[model samples]
Target: MTMKKEYRVKKNTDFQAAFKKGKSFANRQFVVYSLKKPEQKHFRIGLSVSKKLGNAVMRNQIKRYIRQAFLEMENEIQNEYDYIIIARKPVTEMGLQEIKKSLTHVLKLSKVLKA
Candidate 1:
């Protein structure tokens, strides 16, 4: 499925706001930061894969996997938050299922998953 622009957290200010004001949860492979934005009409997601994880190729691979994972849960997500998913080093070796599992686990911990 395609990720529409409305579903993306696109600004530096948005990233910084999530980091500064959002609640965070972590698992083995991912750190999730979420800020509740009640006025927003949709969930906006930002993916962050640091250089510490790898070189350009590896980082892109991890990002692609994360985007795919988020897409899987897109329809089931609530529309009141902005979420930032940060990939840790171990995530570099994880496949799609692992990524999806980690994302779901974190979102559940943060109570972002829709009923």
Candidate 2:
């Protein structure tokens, strides 16, 4: 079977676009920004982990968790949206499934993923 390539929003401008052109919010465990990226026909996602949350290892852990969650759920998601996920301090204590649920919840609330 052919693999599906996941798209990522990597440029700083893409994050800026999500904040400026799209809607955003903060939950108890995460902050989410989402918008439609007309430049893409599929979905793209980005993740953030500030040093304020921890050292390099902690930050990388959070990034990895979010990225995997995004990849796994990207297919079931709606199209044309660019999403940015920022992990809060509490996120370090969460399990992968919890992270996935939070990501899915925010995306759904943003209406980037249709129910």
| lDDT on C-alpha atoms for all candidate structures | 0.89, 0.78
Instruction: Report backbone clashes per prediction.
Output: 0, 0
* Error at 34, model 2, angstroms: 0.8
lDDT of 1 by residue, 49-80 (tens): 88998899999988888888888888878889
Cα lDDT of model 2 by residue, 1-115, tens digit = 2214466778998788888888887778888887876677887778788899889998987877888887787677777777788888889888889988888877777666655
TM-score of 2: 0.85
Report RMSD (Å) for each prediction in the order shown. 1.2, 2.8
lDDT score at residue 109, model 1, on the 0-100 scale: 88
- Residue 55: error of model 2 in Å? 1.1
| Candidate 1: Cα lDDT at 21 | 96
**Best TM-score goes to which candidate?**
1
**Quick one: best lDDT, which candidate?**
1
